[model samples]
Target: MNKFGVLSFLMALISVIVFLILRGPNVNLLLMAIILGSLSLLGIIFAVISKRWLSGIIGVLCNSVVLVSAYFTLLAYGIAG
Candidate 1:
């Protein structure tokens, strides 16, 4: 198991969970979303560098989802604000 792969996966998983929790009530959190999105982007980079293919792919997919959701949140609040 590649260390970076596992790290990226955990980072993405935590970001997703935190996003769900924070956005559950549709909180207007542009800064928070941006921060999470950036963190997830880092995770994606780590995923790409990871040697374990399976974990790396999963990390990429999960981080991608978080990235999309973060941007969506940004769009929703940024325009509305």
Candidate 2:
């Protein structure tokens, strides 16, 4: 049970859920994207720093997915690429 990995996994899950639930073109889309990107970035860092391999890898993968998909969604709307 690596603490860093657990924390990273939690952050990744939260970001993914938020991205899915609040997804769409809206006034706060940019802000949400930025915040989610930062959250995923931190998750990636923590995953790299984690001692356990499984949790760390899962955290990194999930966070990566969230980060890329969120940006791509924004890119689709001509927001940020």
lDDT of each: 0.83, 0.82
> Which regions in candidate 2 have their CA more than 4 angstroms from the true location?
24-27, 79-81
Clashes of each: 0, 0
Model 2 lDDT tens row, 1-81:
678988898888889777777766664666777878888999999998996889888988999998997687567657444
TM-score of each: 0.82, 0.80
- Tens digit of per-residue lDDT, candidate 1, span 6-80: 889888978967776776565758876877898799899999899778988898998998898888878888788
Task: Name the TM-score of candidate 1.
Answer: 0.82
Candidate 2 backbone collisions, by pair: none
Q: Where is the poorest 10-residue window by lDDT in model 1?
A: 19-28
